[model samples]
Target chain A: MIWLVWRQHRKQALFALAALAALAALVVPTGLTMRGAFADLGLPDCVRTLGKAGPANNETCLTAFQQFNDEYQGFLLVGILFLVLPLLVGLFWGAPLVAREVEHGTHRLVWTQGVSRRQWALAKFGLVGAATLVIAVGYGLGIGWWLGPLNSAGQRNRFDPLFFDMQGAVPVGYTLFAVALGILVGTVWPRVLPAMAGTLVGFLGLRVVLATLARPRYLPAETLTFPIQGTAVAPRETASDWVLASGVRNASGELVVRGGSIECPPNATGPGAAGCGTGLGVEPGAYNWQLYQPADRFWLFQGIETGIFVALAVLLVYLAVRRIRRIA
Target chain B: METALETDQLGKRYGNTWALRDCSLHLPAGRIAALVGPNGAGKSTLLHMAVGLLRPDAGTVRVFGETPYDNTAALAEIGFVAQDTPLYRDFTAGELVTMGGKLNRRWDGTLARTRLAQLGIPPDKPVGKLSGGQRAQVALALALAKRPRLLLLDEPVASLDPLARREFLQALMGSVAESGTTVLLSSHLLADLERVCDYLIVLHGARVRLVGPVEDLVAEHRQLVGPRHGDDPIPGVASVVRASHTDRQSTLLVRTDGPIGDTSWAAHEVTLEDVILGYLADGDRPTSNEAWGVPA
Candidate 1:
């Protein structure tokens, strides 16, 4: 049975591996260069003591850090690839798994063999599911390694939706979920192209809704009050705070909307234009209250998100098996 | 003794239409049964149900006296080559045989190899590149490699040319001769089933119209000719399967157990094709033998 599954899907499995290999080729070299640059500029120690640097050293370290960061805009492409990798898995690997068999009338061939339909489905899911997880894990490790310096420098947040999904264990969950979604749609549609289309649309819709609406509420946001120090609290001190929302509030918990200054030209692109509306007015004793998930909760949030998607993947696979049984 | 295949009031419906309904059969073991019916007569539906590829909406179907639906042990005793003989287009013939060997506990790899070798097919060639007849042969080889107790084929040669169809059937008969496997094959082409089958199950209008040994069924039905008779009943006839009247004479295809000894009628033995056509013609109008005014 294992041999059967491998024989049927070796092409797809190899294709996935080749994709990962290509990504490795790109990230490995770029990652080494970036590390070399970081070390050569002596930015490691500076980044390690970023917050406590003396004014004179701070200026020089900041310039070195900017140069290191500017050397690799290629990471943006890698980010986009990780974001779309799950959909590619769903379309090429998952959707075609069952849909092509049905479309080509080959399901009848395997179904009528000594193996039962349930066994056939189990073998397929077992092999392909494992392959998808391996690819996702490899990708996760590669991207995490590539982004390690930026993250340690406090330039990238672990909680932002894009970075969070691309690193840690969340990519594994997303890959599994996308594959499950593909299988479910393929079984229901029983046609290759339509199932692929449906999976792409369904997967994108699910990721968007989950990331924007459902993810932040996985754990309650912590509330904090601090004195409104000169203009807008300087955006949070920690890059990974994952601020859900923050604004001026009176002691009674009411919002105080500050009006923009009439003296600034609207939508200016000049250097100081961004801060033009701030310092317009200040309410006495009013503090800037924040609702946020702090950086320390990164693992907890990762666990929660992965748990939800893995659970959904399991359900989709179960449903796909049931549908396979009923296919006859 | 367990029969090769049996169905008890088997019924299947597609939406508002009934593809097969109230169908029942008891095919004895070791008989090469041929299911003959015109297009849309539920022949494929019956075969599909028997192999467990289709679930009956009502009643039950058993292969080797056990329900095959999700029953691996029962399913293991049966092998099916569905219509068009669908195989993986990209898999080489040898790879498909390898798959068969891996998937089936009872698979005969040597038998598969020998069969393909005898067919003069290159084992390394992809199935998609094979001719329609070669593809059919490969499909049959895969199914036969399982060494099933009962082999079910649905129009395996439906798409082949005359020579290919003959070759395909020749290989099938060769296997049957070698292994004594009970085979139940369905085809609408009466010419195809005439020489190969001993038992016959004729289906029409989603019902079994005639089922018995070919020799017995042929012996029981007679073509009767006599003077014009009104829509009147005829004695010594079990049922008038078909009837037509000319200005001066009447021709009737009738089923009966007794000998037709009346001087008013000329009796002639019926051919299997004639018997099948008679039943199929009666298929459009639903009526039974008892409803034909035969005295109880």
Candidate 2:
């Protein structure tokens, strides 16, 4: 059974390896160059002072930082690629795993062999599932290593949703989940094109929902309050804290609107319109706003998100097996 | 003889229509059985159920007296060739045989290689490049290499030319001679099966219309010619399968167990094709002009 699975999927597995190799070939040199620049140009010390530490008063360090960011524009595209890689895996590798067999009536051939359906399903999932995980982990390692300097230098937020999914452990979990989803959809739909389309749409939908709606509440976000001073809202507490929502409270203790903007009645006029009742106010501690999930909780959030996706992947595998058994 | 395959009121429905209904039949061990039916007559459905590829909506289907659903031991006893004889288009014939050996506990690798060799199929040639006949041979070799006690084939030669069909059947007969495996072959055309099968199961309208030995079925059903009877039942005629009556003469294909002792009518032998056609045509409203001897 293992040999059969290998014969069937060796081409795909080798293709996935080739893709990972290509990605590594591109990322390794760029990563080494970034590391060299970080050292040769004293960008580490420059980041220490000119980044979130204090004001950008040193012109030389600021120029170095700007040059570093400019040189790594391709890093952001790589990040986006990492984000879309799992969907591609689900679409091509996982969706077609079973859908192609069914569409071409080869499932009848395989299932009619001496092996039972359970055994066949196990062999397929075990091989393809493991390959998907390895590819995802390889991708995460390369992309994360390339972005390590930028992340630590405060050029990018460690807790930002855009960067979080492309970093440590979570990408592997996401890949497993996508593969399981693809297998489930392929088994249910039993058509290659439709299953591939369904997997792409389904994976993207789940990812969007998880990143936008679910990740923020993985842990109770901590709130920070500061007194309103002058017309300007002070900067956030830290550059790495994710600010989920910030709003000013009214006299009735209800959040009126976003913290920075203030609305006035149409009939209101003169200086008062430009002051407390209409514009930026200076009432100390009267209405403070909040930020969410700080940088320190990054690992905790990764663990929780990975846990959720891994659990869902296992459930989907079980569902796929049951569906395979139910096929007639 | 032990029963190789049996269905107890097996039935299946697709949406609002029944594809097979109460189709109970049994084939004894060591006999070559023919499952004859027209298109949509549920022959494939019945064979699929027997091999556990399909689930019956109504009743039980057993192979070698054991239920085949999810039972690995029961499944190993039967081999099946689907209608199109699907194979991996990318794998060479050698790889497919290797796959068969790895997947089946009792796979006969030497037999697979020798059989493909005999068929003039190169071991390294991919199935996609092979002709339809060669692909069918590969499929049959894979099944026979399992050495199953019962083999079920669904229109294995439907797409082959006459010579290829004859060669395919000859290969099948060779294997049957060596192994004595009970075979249930399904085909819409009885002429394709007349030379190979000894037992017959005729299906029509999702129901079993006839089940018996080919010789007994032929000998039991007789074609009668006599004066026109005008839609009335005649004495000594068991049941009219097909009838065509002219202005002065009537020709009727009837099934009966008793001897035709009537002196007024003459009896003629019924070919297997004629018997199959009569049963299938009887599915529609039988015409008095549809009998074999009468002109339309």
Candidate 3:
């Protein structure tokens, strides 16, 4: 089944491999050493800027060694890449698995062939599902090896939440989640381009809203909003912001914060809180909000969240299978 | 009569409009039946019911004396060819044949191979690249390779050219003759239908208008040309499918069990197309001729 699915999607596989290979070759230097200029251009300067660059470093060997040991934040890019395309495949490629047949009335031929609708749908889902798993793992392994040096160097650098949460097993988990989301969207909207746009728009919207609503400026625990002195946005969006970090919990526990700094509202009562009701308060710690460290709780929360999304995916798939089977 | 497929007053409604109403058909084994109608005549709906694709709001469809759904053993007795003949564009002909072979228990790989070869679909050619006519042939091959007891086809040749459609029907009839398989195919081309179909079902306005053996139907109905007497009906005429009159003469398409004894109207033998168009015209009228249980 997977072989069939892969055969159909060999074009995408080839494209992904080509992209990865080209990037790898562009970065390669003689003997694949840290002495290469590509190494300096990619991370050495960035590490020095972070005040963590080591001298005359065998960074390639370090990078190669750290590929497994150190968590590569760049693996998140792999997640983003896998996240976007498979979703497209699901919408454009997978959506037509049944709906197109029914739309064109070809499903009737397949339907009457003594193969139950359940079996038919199962074959498609099983095949595509396996393909997704393989793609996620392959991508995860490749990026983990390629960007090892940056991750090891960044361990000494200031807290960069993007790279911080991207290491180890988390990127793989997130990519799978995104792919599942894409599949679910495909099931819901079976027309090719519409499903693709819908998945992108819907997921992007949800991510944006979640990021905003869970931020300290929008809503804080006990306090309506944070009372930070000034907005502390980074020069680049890639710069680590403590407030919007993923795996971070919300004050109300209803949601999770992704990353960004939030500006606060006034205090509720007492001391400086007396001026809070009548005035636009400027005092720091007037409604003090604390940021939590990434801990066991964070991973537990991540696991729980990914599990819920996966469950939703499974339910959508079940409904889709039933729908396709009901087609005569 | 012992029937291979039977529908007991099957009815289906989509929202406010009824797509099929009280449609009853009994097709016996080893007969080539054709379901004929104009567009939106409930032909597709009725076929869907027979194949267990759609559930009737009222009544039932039984295949080989049982429902065709979920019952794998029951379905194994049937193969279907649907209209539009759509295939996965990315898959090659070889892959599709392989798929059919793997999925079906009674699959005849030799038949698929032979048919595919005869159809001239090379092994590596993508289904997407095949022309409309070639795709239809591949679809037919897929259906026949199952070695079904009963074959249900919905408008299998609606899009094919004259030669290709003729070839499809001929090949199908040839296979049926060899295997004694009961085939039910739907098509709009009367000439092709006349050549192959022994049994006929005419559907109009979501209802079965007329059904019987082709020979009997052709024998009973006649294209009569004569002067109209609005006050006096034709002698022994069961039903007038359509009536159009000029000042000097009237033409009445009449269907009767026996001959209508009207010397004034020259009883000309009706072609299959005339028979089909007649029923369609009858079903189109603000009908009061509800001798059968046709819904109001």
Top-lDDT structure, candidate number: 2
- All candidates' chain B TM-scores are 0.93, 0.93, 0.90
lDDT, candidate 1, at A89: 88
CA-lDDT, candidates in order: 0.82, 0.83, 0.64
In the range A183-301, model 3's lDDT, one tens digit per residue, is 55555655555655666676556544533443233223221234333323212221222333322223344323334433423334446545332243223233323353322243444
What's the residue-level lDDT of B259 in candidate 1?
77
Tell me how far the alpha carbon of residue B228 in candidate 3 is from the true structure, in angstroms, after superposition: 3.1
Q: On a 0 to 100 scale, what is the lDDT of residue A328 in model 2? A: 61
Clashing pairs in 3: A225-A264, A226-A264, A227-A264, A244-A258, A244-A259, A244-A260, A245-A258, A245-A259, A328-B53
lDDT of 1 by residue, A178-269 (tens): 99999999999989899999999998898899999999999888986665544322434334578777777655767674321122333433
The residue-level lDDT of candidate 1 at A218 comes to: 90
Candidate 1 residues lying further than 4 Å off, grouped into runs, are A50-57, A152-156, A230-238, A250-252, A258-282, B227-229, B245-250, B261-264, B282-296
Model 3 chain B weakest 10-residue run by lDDT: B280-289
TM, every model:
0.89, 0.91, 0.74
- For model 2, residues A121-217, the per-residue Cα lDDT tens digits are 9988998898888788888777778877777555566677778888888888889998899899989999999998898888888889989988899
lDDT of 3 by residue, B1-296 (tens): 56888988889888999999988889988889999988888888887777777767889889889886566777788877777786766678888888777667888978988988987888788888998788887887888888988888888888888888878778888888999998888888888888898999998889898888888898888888887658476786888888888998888888876767767778889887788888877534566658766776
